[model samples]
Target: MRRPLRILQATALALCLLTTAAPASASAASSPAPSPPSAAEAGPVLAVPADLAAEEVSFRGGGGLAMRGTVLSPAKAPVEGGPGRPGIVLVHGSGAGVSRTKLREEAVAFARQGLSVLIYDKRSEGYSLFRRSYPQLADDALGAVAALRSRPGVDPAGVGIWGFSEGGWVAPIAASRSADIAFVVLVGANGMPPLRQQTWAVAAGLRKAGVSGSLVERAEPAMYRLIADGGLFPEPYHDPGPTLAAVRQPVLGVWGVHDLLTPPAENPPLVARALEKGGNRRYTFHFFPGADHAAHLSPDGGVTRLPELAPGYADLVGSWVRDVTAGRTPVAGTSGPAPVQDSATVPMGPAARWESAPVQLAALVLFAVAFAAYPLVALVRRLRGRSRRPVTRAARLLAATGAAAVLGLFCYLFYVLTTGAKLAAPGPVAAGRPLIWLALQVLAVTCVAATVLTASAWYRSRGSADPARPGERGERVRLGLLLAGGAVFVPWALYWGLLLP
Candidate 1:
């Protein structure tokens, strides 16, 4: 009996082990497989044509940002007689974001013409993260140059940076820090101090919109004060001249004759002169006649209807960029054909020229005056009338003032919206009109709401109703006023300013 029992126990233990082990083995086999590698990790380097393939490369920069750019050899395939290609890095202008499409287009154009090109996004723009500081961007650009030098296709000794607008400013600073950068191309750059640049940008914008010479003259001091004090007049003033003069690099400056943002009178030549004064001989300047900023491309590039000017302007830039990269001198003169007779002849009178300045000034002054005077006037009337009336009068006065403010705000917003629409035609005056109008509308609505709510509460407390049960009817009326005011302000402002612009 004991032997039989032992046999059965041993069999049962073996059976239990098999049951548990079988499920475990099956689970191991049935589990999901691991995922494939991501695109960034795989690092698939794109191939160029057989002749151009020698220049193609992928490199990693110091900021932990991987940059992918192309190298273009001077000859088709392997050639015996041709010189090696020079290298150029194309930097983009400021816009909604760093333009990868623009950069690629520029690189390909230069590459086809026998040059190696590296164009990458600024940190926080394009494929990179957003909101990176200027210093970080400069560092990334520096890193790109270092990476290019290590690559097989690039001529480490011959590297340059071609920058536009903000890029122009950044290139000099970066070049100063790195010896690798051999030259710089600055499109629509200015030599004046930054404060002066700011003032000039504003003044030029005004002049383009048809502002009077006298007003511009009068406004200059205030504009200077605004920049000097860092907004409106304050105490210490900051100057930006010395910083600009510190840049030591070969520069090529380009500007548009009708560039309202940085007027020709205030920009290109001025920048060239600054460099010249610094005893820098390696400089070239070019200005496009009758061309608005970024509008003139290849002399025959037609007026583009795109909202942003980057696309229409990219080709001309690519052409010049090709020359710079190929170690050829850039021709400094007008490009593309003149505009059509009708388009070229559109008259820009005085009113159209300086429209931005006066409109902006008027709106600012109105807001300031309204905010300051209304409260003081209301207080004075309340105190003077207190001798003959009950204390409740103060509360009523406050409510009345609040109501008036709301009314004024409604009027201001209405004017901004309607006038903004009227100003939106494709002319000099309307260029910055939309931004100005929107700011004014925001100020008006904010001021009215703040004053009305604060003042009405003060007035209601002064009334002779029960301390705990002050008039619900009056409170509701005031609440209704606030709501009604917003309802009137929003739609009207949008319809006038946005739709019109």
Candidate 2:
């Protein structure tokens, strides 16, 4: 009976496995093979000028990935016109998936301006049926240039590429490989070494969070290491400096003043420095005030979210393109002035000095409180023995101290937040002097509160005697010491470990 049952169970398991595997195998086997275009399908249908249409094109890119793109052209060249019109390519940033909508809009915008535009889905984005790698993306861009050149109304000699964010890097890398690219526009592009950029980003975030200077200083190394390792601890991603230096094209780098993710302060100077070193005077930079990373989606200062197009970005970009394509020098005032220094200048204001002092004082006070609070509570418990009191004075002291400590922490956080905001705001008065005063106040309040809370918690616990041994204090002194130690060290650890980079 047992043998038969075991055999039956084995048979059921085999059937289940076959059922699950059959569909996947059949699906793979039955998938259709791709077909190629016949000779008759080689050229686009030539409609009249009023009936111009867009067409989809597919080709193989680098690493054997099938790439797809859309090409828009004048249905019929004007009777008196030459063989082709100027061609342009639009490259997308890393966002909620690259789409043809942006490309279509760009193509129509350029087409309206009398230039043919070829906009394609990036590898693995939109309708393209392949995963993308950096090398593959570069190849796709090159392929786009080639596809546009082959179109009937596109002039191979007048080709250019416009890229945003990560696309900025892609455009130049692609342009370097193709001689047909006439020019390039890079929006929110960086020229800094990747490590420096990452460090700056971390520091800016910590500053915004109201972390103090001493803590920031101590934390800087750890933060840099985190960035250097590319969010991992062992290895880094791409190195920006070497990669950027390789491209030798005329570039217009655009950035926003209030961009927190990739601050202009970190990248603009790097670009300017690189240009000076290379003796390449062909680049230009434009910085917009009060704009974030996704500035293109928020042109009118209304919405401040990502992925939305900033107001006036398209117009600004369009103008830049026209000037570059027409061989006109960008007016110096339109693109912001060149960076003055290669590295960020550290400000030595009153805020910096005060921050250092308060942090040192806080650390010392915390240490004292941690060592003294317990002993003081124990002495009081011994003196008040056998009182039969409902609440012991020692326990009351501990509760009061805890409350005060909590209050002090809240006040300190508030002051830091307010001060940081003021410092980062546009029209900066002297924030350093005021910040110093604020830091001192925070230190004083926190010290007093920590002392009071340690005492209060100790007092309150002594009052809660055990039911069997009603008069005895239950090791309240030891617990108070532990709490005090935590209060002293946790904040310092957070500050020194994460904020300074």
Alpha-carbon lDDT, every model: 0.45, 0.51
Highest-scoring model, TM-score: 2
Candidate 2: residue 293 Cα off by (Å): 3.1
lDDT of 2 by residue, 118-161 (tens): 67655443222111345556777787788777877666777788
Instruction: Tell me the deviation in Å of residue 435 in model 2.
Output: 20
Instruction: Write down the worst ten-residue block by lDDT for model 1.
Output: 341-350
lDDT of 1: 0.45
lDDT string for model 1 (86-192, tens) is: 56776666543353555554455556655666765443322211112344456666766775666554567767776665566656667767778866766655454
Q: lDDT winner among the candidates?
A: 2
Global local distance difference test of model 2: 0.51
